[model samples]
Target chain A: DAGVTQSPTHLIKTRGQQVTLRCSPKSGHDTVSWYQQALGQGPQFIFQYYEEEERQRGNFPDRFSGHQFPNYSSELNVNALLLGDSALYLCASSFGNPPSGYTFGSGTRLTVV
Target chain B: QKEVEQDPGPLSVPEGAIVSLNCTYSNSAFQYFMWYRQYSRKGPELLMYTYSSGNKEDGRFTAQVDKSSKYISLFIRDSQPSDSATYLCAMGPSQGGSEKLVFGKGTKLTVNP
Candidate 1:
């Protein structure tokens, strides 16, 4: 079985630009969550998507948004990105019903210059 | 203060040594605890998870949660070089459907051969 997968293992964008990162949840999982990990820091929750709706969000700004498709794949969009946005974006999949263990992707590392 | 706080240690120990990693939280609502290991330039992988205050072990990794004291721990036995990485602690409510995970800053460990 395939684990959680994310697209563009690395990305580079400029300030004020927009970036879109994609994630496919692990098989048999329904919930998708996004996290941001700066260098030498643990991940900070961005938001979670279930049933195509964002359920819970962290303290991030409105520039960060996400979408979950019916197939359980998700996308994270960051608008007006700043240099501070350069970090590793992780996608984790879990079962929402019983809340099982999470499977995380290798993550997309974004570099804003 | 942050909801979850961890010592970001560049802890170096010899192979076969016992290692203890810990996190303390200020949020009493957190009901679920998790430990994640991440290598350099990679996303975190779930190591072990505990529901509440108790000890859970898997192989050489043990997770201990003391909710009453708001402290959690991960211990590695017979540590190996492959175990060198950053360890993260995450927590959320037991219900777990839409609850957000609060993460610590992570501790870095290096197992010297």
Candidate 2:
């Protein structure tokens, strides 16, 4: 069985531009959540998608958004990216209402220039 | 104060040495505690998890949680160079409600051969 997979292992974007990172959750999982991990720090929750709708969000600004497709894949979109937005974007998947434990992808490294 | 606090240490130890990592949380509501290992440029992989307050062991790794003190620890015995990575501590509330993991800054460990 395949674990979570993320596209474009590494990405480079310029300021004011927008970028979208994709993720396919592990098989048999339904819920998807996104996290931002800055260098030298732990990951911070961006948001979570369940049932194709955003269920809970962190303190992130509105510029960070996400979507969960019917197939349980997820996409994280960051608009008007800033230099500070450069970080590792990780996707985690779990099953059902309260995720027992999350399985995370390798993550997409976003570099803003 | 941050919800979770951990020392970001580039901790170095000789191979086969026993390693101990810890994290403290300010939120008493957090019911589940976890430890994740992340290699450079990779997403975190769950290493150990515990609920309630006790010790859970898996092979050379042992996880201990002290709910009364709001502290959690991960211990590695007979560590190897492959064990060198950043260890992250994460916690969340019960699964029935919103499940969002709050993570610590992570402690980097290097097991030198």
Candidate 3:
């Protein structure tokens, strides 16, 4: 079975620009979550989309937003990016109410220049 | 203080040695614990997960959780070069109503031949 798939493996954007990263969740999964991992740090939770709506969010600012489609594909959009936003954006998928094991995609490397 | 604290160890050890990684969490509500392994620039791969205080063993890797002390540990036995990666400890409350995970900074281990 295919696992999660994320688009735009690598991206370089300038400060103040916007970027959209996409993800196709693993087959048989219906929930999508986004995370940001800086160099030498673990992935930090961004937000999670369930039932095509955001069900939970972390401490990220409003500049970070995401959407989930009916097919369980998701997109993470960052507006007015800053250098600190440069990191590996990861998309993970699972199917359950809570405490499900997440299958993660390779992730998109966002470089804010 | 950070919700999770871990020593970001670039620990070097010889092949076949036992490696221990640990993380301490400050959240008392956390009940679900997990360990993830991540290679450079790659998303984290779930290693093992345990709920509450108990010992879980999967092949050469073992996970232990001490809920009373708010501490968790991952032990790798007969370590191999392939086991060299950043090990992250993640936790969340089982009843907190979301799959959001708080993660540690991760411990980097290098097993030499």
Candidate 4:
């Protein structure tokens, strides 16, 4: 009955440093996707994990990567953070169904200093 | 041009008024449409979704997708203060092949009592 959950509601990192954000998908869901939402802008797709492998990815650079565990929990890692990397990191969970809508977790706010 | 475009309005309205939110997409391949609501500092919550085209209503919210014009809309009736949030329009092709929600810059709505 629990919805998608994310950890480290807020984080701060400096240039050249890395940060990892965690997410636990909603119960009964298997696919996990990560998004980055900047202030005053909509989210940009980072990547998606299904069957413990990355299935699809967006236009993000190599600095962004993620993993999905067997339990359906996922983590997003960003390296060499820049000020532009500061944004709200959203974790959305969905089944592989065609019409399935994603259930989102309360995002982790990353502040690159 | 952005794949999806929306007016980032701090749209203000009175309680009980009808509110309309909209988005336009340039990608013709996008068939699954969705609306998500995000409160400040929170991840987006799925409001409603429509596959292909047509209208889908849930309680006070209605989502309309017009694929011909590549436009979509979300209407809120009898709006309440709790409805005040950033409404995001997201769309992409169904999962299993391409699974990502290309989102628009959210429209912020404020319903006053």
lDDT of each: 0.92, 0.93, 0.92, 0.91
Distance (Å) between predicted and true CA of A71, model 4?
1.2
Best by DockQ: 4
Query: What TM-scores do the predictions have?
Result: 0.96, 0.97, 0.97, 0.96
Winner by DockQ between candidate 3 and candidate 1: 3
Q: What is candidate 4's lDDT per residue for A1-113, written digit by digit as tens?
A: 99999999989888889999999999999999999998988999999999999989998999999999999899999988899999999999998667489999999998987
Candidate 2 Cα lDDT to native: 0.93
lDDT of 3 by residue, A1-113 (tens): 99999999999999999999999999999999899999988889999999999989998999999999999999999999999999999999988755467889999999999
CAPRI accuracy category, model 4: high
Task: Report the C-alpha lDDT of model 2 over B1-113, residue by residue, as the tens digit.
Answer: 98999999989999999999999989888888899999999999999978769999999999999999989999999999999999999999634456889999999999999
- Per-candidate RMSD, Å: 1.6, 1.4, 1.2, 1.5
Sort the predicted structures by DockQ, highest score first.
Answer: 4, 2, 3, 1
The DockQ-derived docking category for candidate 3 is medium
- Residue A24, model 4, lDDT: 96
**Could you tell me how far off, in angstroms, the CA of residue A73 lies in candidate 2 after the best superposition?**
0.6
**Per-residue alpha-carbon lDDT of model 1 for B1-49, expressed as tens digits?**
9889999988999999999999999878787899999999988899998
How do the candidates score on chain B by TM-score? 0.95, 0.96, 0.95, 0.96
For every prediction, compared with the true complex, DockQ reads 0.78, 0.84, 0.79, 0.91
TM-score of chain A of 1: 0.98
Q: What is the lDDT of candidate 3?
A: 0.92
Please, what are the lDDT tens digits per residue for candidate 3 over residues B9-91? 88999999999999998888887899999998888899998978999999999999998898999999999999999999988
Off by over 4 Å in 4: B94-97
Query: Could you tell me how far off, in angstroms, the CA of residue B113 lies in candidate 4 after the best superposition?
Result: 1.2
In the range A28-78, model 2's lDDT, one tens digit per residue, is: 999999999999999999998988999899889999988989998999999
